[model samples]
Target: MTLTRRSFIAATSAATGLIATPAILRAQGKLALRMGHPHPESDSWQDVALWMNETLNEQSNGEITLQVFPNGLLGNDPTMINSVRAGSLDIALTGNPFFTSLAPELNVLDLPFLFRDRDHVARVLDGEIGDRLRRNFDGTGLHALAVWETGWRHVTNSRRPVVEPADIKGLKIRTTPNPAHIEAFRLLGAVPTPMAFTELFTALEMGAVDGQENPTTLILNSRFYEAQKYLSLTQHAFTASPLVTNADKLAAMGEDQRNLLIATAQEGAKRQRAMNAEREQSSLEALKAEGMEAVEAPDREAFRAIVAGPVQATFAAEFGSDLIDQINAA
Candidate 1:
């Protein structure tokens, strides 16, 4: 049976009743917030989570603090995201793809070769384009707080180097369940297998999939180099992690408290973005040091030329080209 978001929520709703909320509201009006993400404790996601916790404590004069659960302790991306929407979880951090089902307009950001660089991403995501996409969260039970960078995604495989589109032909590549990503890989001549990120490493180790694509930071932090042999700097697409909270929960908070929560999250996002950029080269170097062959200059133009037109047209037909045009113009 296929599990849609609604069904997943229903299936998990009963289970949620058994889990206690980690947050505490003191008699003195102080509140503790709980946040969760799928990345390990060593990744930048955890670093920012801790940073935000400190900032929130200091800014709130000890009235507010965060309890962070990393490495999918709460659940995978989709589960945690649904928990937040269902008010069982306070907050969640997940890549754009995980939220696309709740807001399909976000698929625009998942397009291959869509973002030229970090600057282009900043221009779009930190501007009106980002605001418009965040508004899409309304009525979905999530309050979009801020946009954080996951960096440009690259391809890694155990089979061989993937420098051009043809190199990946017939190879099974694991991808996020984002339609744009699946469509892009399919157009590039590879079998696109979509699955949860949690299953990727074991699948690769067991030869369930030949390769996978992810940000250099995630590839290194997740230790994919142990199972994958080649690292191609495809930069096929950029991913953004949206920090979101339960919409009803946020609305229930005092005006000042709500503003503080949003403001601190955005500030944390800025720091995470800078840190992500600083670590990109170092992460790539670390992957190479780990014995993975690095394809420094893969034929990006060739790869992009193959998937750009068709993928964009297919998405535009469904989502309209106005947002795409706005992003391009930005």
Candidate 2:
């Protein structure tokens, strides 16, 4: 019997039999998981969220459902995270840095030059290191379902093209509320201002921030080009956005439902990563058409060197020397 993905899922559901629908599973009383992210509905993050909703619902035969709140509708990343911890929010898809305040070990993934490329990021994430990070979330009142890459970050601004570290001097850049990201731009000579993703477009349009750094897909998906002109391919950090659920809510699920949720999340993550990569490739052309100067071959190593030492020192105490060595070796 050739078992396809859909067939395998159906078979597994049959094996689990007709499980009693928890009161929370009723149509009127369905447990609605509120997932928050900073991207609009058109973004890749939303694509993944929709996929999870569809897959999880089908797998559980409508017993589990997800309600997505996109474009920071619930609040900024930090606010959303706090809500999740407090059990007010059910789930969220957010950058790892937001959770660093809770789990410092996650900072290892934020090191400026740690990942040589996308493949390295995936290898480490899908390997023991990723498992270790997931394990660390056990007692944090949250459960990490999967880690998905957002591609390498690049700098986009209305100022002059950034080809070297010195060019970024005095430029006001908006960054996520991550210490490492703030320090990175500060070390590169830009004044990094931490802000919510939803506020970025307005901040740029109003000249509140000279530029910001994000992946190509983000720059295009968020229509950052409407407010910025120059894009520097610094490729500084490869961000991992984890799909996290409240531990209490997750713990209440049956074994079959739990397994299905995790499986669906993993599958959704794969789809998200592929969509992000595809968007990254085509975003340059889209930006160019929009009259944005896409700067290429910028001295990435020069910028990397600026933040390398400080970021390493900041995280060395948490990740310890061995894991850092493993990432460096990779």
Query: Which regions of candidate 1 are displaced past 4 Å?
Result: 1-18, 22-26
**Could you list the CA RMSD of all candidates, in the order they appear?**
6.5, 7.3
- Per-candidate TM equals 0.93, 0.88
Please give, for residues 33-74, the per-residue lDDT of candidate 2 as tens digits.
556687766778877776788777787777777666677766
- Model 2 pairs in collision: none
Model 2 regions more than 4 Å off: 1-31, 317-319
Candidate 2 lDDT score relative to the true structure? 0.79
Q: lDDT tens string, model 1, 1-330? A: 422323234324533443475433455878778787887666788788878888888989989987777767778889999888877778899889989998998899998888877899999999988998899999899998899877889999999999898999988999999999999999988999998787788999999999999989999999999999999999999999899999988888888888999999999899999988889999999999999999999999999899988899998999888888888888
- Candidate 1 residue-wise lDDT at 141: 94
Worst 10 residues of 1 by lDDT: 2-11
